[model samples]
Target chain A: MTALPDTTGKKLGLVIDLDTCVGCQACATSCKEWNTQGYSAPMTDRDPRGSDPDGPWLNRIHGYEIEPESGHDSRVVHFPRSCLHCETPACVTVCPTGASYKRAEDGIVLINPDTCIGCKLCSWACPYGAREYDVDHGVMKKCTLCVDRIYNENLEPEDRQPACVKACPTGARHFGDLGDPGSAVSQLVLERGGFDLLPEMGYKPTNKYLPPRTKRNTPQAGIEALPKGDGSAMDRLFKLADRLLSGAGN
Target chain B: MNPAYSVIFFTTASGAGYGLLALLGLTGARMGHAPSLLFAILTLIIALGLITAGLLSSTLHLGRPERAWRALSQWRTSWLSREGVAAIVTYPFALAFGLVWSGLVAIPDAVAPLGILTAILALTTVFTTGKIYATLTTIRAWNQPLTVPIYLFFALASGGALHWAISTILGMEPGTVPPVAGFALLMLAMLKLRYWGLIDNAPRDRTMANATGLGEHVRQWEVPHTSTNFVQREMGFVVARRHAQRLRKIFFLLLLLAGGLEGAATSVPAFAVPAALILLIAAWLERWLFFAEGEHVVTLFYGNPNA
Candidate 1:
């Protein structure tokens, strides 16, 4: 089972937009809030109210300042990091137990806690740090792409999506079958020139990231004086009436 | 990257045990010529004891040690699984080699073939263990051509030193043991130096720009969490350049002293124990450096611009 399947039915993944992300951490917070009680439950925190509070989290937001080549000033870009669910993930093949596996139906990589030995080798094999060891449970925890929520029939049709995607206030995070060329997410990727993180590593990740767009180039707006009215008694009377109605007298 | 003590001890202890086991199996034909029956038994006991203790220590690091048996199921893909299988397969051959050499079993004619088979299996187990680290592409320091060779030679040198010490103590003639072990120690020291050089000069190609798909000059404004997470605590372990250089110097001094003492043990038997002891310390230091200095690619997301 550690050996990956040659082909998958669909490559369901996310496309994150750096330009629109505000680093508000809504996605990360919502991920923790939902997942703590969802599929990988009891996501224990060592010291929640103490100074060194730490726990396992699937989504994390990073902030970086970028200096452009020319014309644009330096700006802060917020980046969200998570598992890409790669086509050839070393993390899957390196698992000694069949606990770590990639779903052939949806191309979603996941860990089976009941069978996991928690040797932590899968964590080392992952370049993106997607796997986190659950110290209390003695098992490995990961994103899972909100498998419990995405396919649940109990919720409303619109509510059936990854927690992070549904929680993104700016609509920076998108989820769909990226393997389909005609899908809306695929079209968005084509329009924005989406790229993969650490493409040189050759994991062939499914998820893509759209780079921050260039700063807009437009002049600042300013107020201008009104042209003199045509020399006419009626025009002058109209101008005086407009000034009185503009709250100038108050 | 955290340099866990359990792993360092496991590799050093088990590697030396396999090395010594292989040597014993090769010399099985001449076991009757040993000083006494007790010598052969003691040597086998030492080898097996080290192996058992090391195997047990390795499981201590696992979060679910009770489920460790599951590790042996994936030899087709995982090197760690392959290592487990190899280690188990070598044990029966090793025990048989012991019985034949101890003059207790009546397989006198099978000595040569059994010796060769046990030796092969022992070396194979060591090779699989080395591949576990060498195959991980996430750590550039461990993912190199020299990683496996260094591990192989260190096992030979450390085990050879122990063999020389034990033979000299038992009043057996130290014919080729001292010289061969000394030479192996020399080769190990040279290989370690080259490995350090290669890792130090490894190119920093995976940078912040490639990580975030941002512009070239990217700097971390702030990390996601204010407190340290599991990734930072485990993979973000960093050793300062000054401290690493100092450790390297200490390792070199220990290795040179151990090598010299191993060579001198041929003339004076008193030098044998000290030489093996020093070599053991040097191997521990080298193993510690191996983990402490390794930088994982995951660190790039935790404010490291390059891996």
Candidate 2:
């Protein structure tokens, strides 16, 4: 049972926009809140109010400063990471108990808590660090893509997406069937040049991240300016010229 | 790659146990011919005890130890399951070999075959254990061609050291086995040093930029959570360079001393127990370093991008 399905009809995954994400933790928090009481309830927080608080979380955000290159300017990118529901997820195949499995219908990777021994090998197998060991329930937890909400017929169609996608304030997160080439998410990825994280590792992650767009013709602004009438007219003109040259260079 | 003590002990102790078991399987027939009942019983007890204790210690790391039995069911894909099944299968052969050697049964020709079977099973179990880590592409430090050989050689070295100690105590002539043990010890030390060198020198194949797929030169500015989380605790363990260097020196020195003492003990005889004990301690330290030094690629997402 641990052997991954040869293929799935639909690969439900996420497409995140790095250019739009504001580095806010809304997606992560909403994911935590929904999953804490959903598929894997009580995602226990160890010493929540104490000095060294820690717990299991399916989604995590990381902020990175990409230094300036020869032509590109420096920028800050916030990366939200979770299980990509990989095509060849080692985490599923490495499970000794067959508790970790991928759905044949949708390609959604999940863990059956009732059978998991919580050996923590799946977490090690995952290159993205998507799986987390739930010390409280003694099971492995991961992103289900809000399986509970996605399939609940009672919920509104528009509200049935993943909690993180629904809660993204800047519309940075998107979810849909990636298996269909004509899907909205797939079209977005195609138009935006979406890429996989750690493509060289060869997990074949389903999720994609659209890179930040290059900054264009915006005038450089600086705090330091020429003092008004503080020197001779020639000196003031020279200072103004220097400032203009610096701004243009920037 | 947190070096959990329970796992370190499990691998170290189990490797040594399996190594000893394999050696005993190769030599049990000759010893049975000697009909040294005491030696047979004591060695089997020691070997089986180490194996049992190591296996039991491994369960301590499991979240539900009672469900450990379920782990053996998925051998078709899981190396851990294969290891479990192999270990379990070897027990009967080991028990038969022990019983025959101890003169509890008069199965004359069965001893050698059973011993060979046990040896094969032991090696298979050890190989599966090594594969468990070697197959993990996530941790670059562990995913390498050298990992399996390193595991195999260390197990042999430790087993050889223990075999020498037991043979010496049993009044056997210090034969070529001592020199073989010495050679294995040297190989283990060299392989471990080479592994360390390779990991240290290897380029950061999974950089933060590649991990995020954003751009090159991406450096972590902030972590997602304010508090430490499971990924940080499990895969974010970091060892300082100074301490790692010191431990490496100690491990090499201890292994060298063990090998030298064991080789010399063949003539002197008095240094055998000390040599085996030192080798055991060295193996433990080496296993500890093995876990502590492994930097999972996922750590790139946290702040230590240039591993």
Candidate 3:
């Protein structure tokens, strides 16, 4: 049913670390690779080789420049975005058909390919834009949290996890039962002070994002350590040249 | 928020249809003398035709139109499903009322009760339609108390205008329809102006920083994709403020013209049809603006400073 359950037996979700993500597309590509052929087959790249290739992808990584209010130096942060599988997901409840639903046992939201009419209401209901419209199949697709491989007895036990989590070279993506406070993922969240995205929206997202940590030795500190040059004409000229060159961006 | 033509057409057409049905049901039993068979047939045909055509047009944008029937199964939670169910239920009430009013069934006592029931169902269907957009919290512009009231007011105004034109065209006395329609048009104009003001001044707190859970001064350095994706195309649609201002002016001007013409029609019947047409055009512009101005929260991740 589209109506959400009162509670789930286990909140199986991912915890993404924004500090370690390198803006690499490994998680996104790996998610596409596994999901396209596994459950929700043929993720449908409308024009793969064309100048403007477009397709449905379950995960995407974005880059941002953060200039903190405090004296923390400005830095670039890479963020990986995906479905949070909220406890009270509007995407599931807004589905006119009973296609979009959250699993009562594990709390992972999934859309039934056979029943989705592709009205795109679920996509509209999502604040994170996690729902992807499959143009070829005329249905909605999204991150299933690797439900197929996560429980497959055929695969090696170590390989049983979400493709995105398994493929993260930096170990930025952690997956486990979030409902249990003693779980490793939950402990990581507690230690890092992991926070929910758009918390004011009040969906109570299951997944959490660990914010980037501040650098101990900032560029300003390093600049202060440099020796003060003797107040010579050539020194002033060199300083002017250095200032002009610094304004140019890569 | 992309303002798909199919949905715009569906809502406007069906909204007006339901409004007309409700009004007809309210006034049907009071008409002491039964109108000619031709008039009755024509009115019912126009109302039902607009409704059926609208319902069909709604499916045009669906990915799997064959599975559209499944939409009616989740009314327990979904406003869209409730709308479907209410719309289907209205059909039977409408048909029964149509038969009695047209003298085809000749059950005089059944007319009043059936008419009341039909009117209630028709209004409920329109209410459900309004809730579909109002309940969606992702789009800040649409998730408001005023949204549903605007929808209801537009329906009554447009439907009232249509009724005036039909009555005048069929040689029936226009009676209080002209004034009632004029009043509805004036009220709609006021409500719409207030709605615009509310949306413009509403606090937009959903920023890129909060949306991504990054620090307060976050700025998007790079998009996730080279080309625009479905989310951008669907929810990131933005309308220039200058163009929207011009359109708002055009909307009010059209509304004024419709109201003046509707008022004039009471004396000179020639103005009635033109008045209705002008009101419909105005309503369509309003509907288009409704979708175009909507700001979805997802757009914040795509570098929209605020939603």
Q: Residue A178 lDDT in model 1?
A: 95
Best by DockQ: 1
Instruction: Please list all clashing residue pairs in model 3, or write none if there are none.
Output: none
> What's the true lDDT of residue B212 in model 3?
88
Writing each residue's lDDT as its tens digit, candidate 1 over A1-250 gives: 7999898999999999998999999999999999899888878888888999888989889899986556556799999998999999999999988888999999999998888998899998999989888998888899999989889999898988999999999999999999999998899999999999999999999999998898875554577887878979999899889888887767
Chain B of candidate 1 vs. true chain B, TM: 0.96
TM-score of each: 0.92, 0.92, 0.93
The CA-based lDDT of model 1 is what?
0.86
i-RMS, each model, one decimal = 1.1, 1.0, 1.0
**B302, model 2: CA deviation in Å?**
0.8
lDDT of 3 by residue, B70-98 (tens): 99999999999999999999999999999
Model 1 chain A weakest lDDT span, ten residues long: A214-223
Clashing pairs in 2: none
Predicted candidate 3 versus true structure: per-residue lDDT over A1-250, tens digit per residue: 9989999999999999988999889999999999999888979898798989999999988889987566666789998999999999999998999999999999999999999999999999999999988999899999999999999999999999999999999999999999999999999999999999999999999999998886785555343567889989999999998888887643
Q: In angstroms, what RMSD does candidate 3 have relative to the true structure?
A: 6.5
Error of 1 at B209 (Å): 0.8
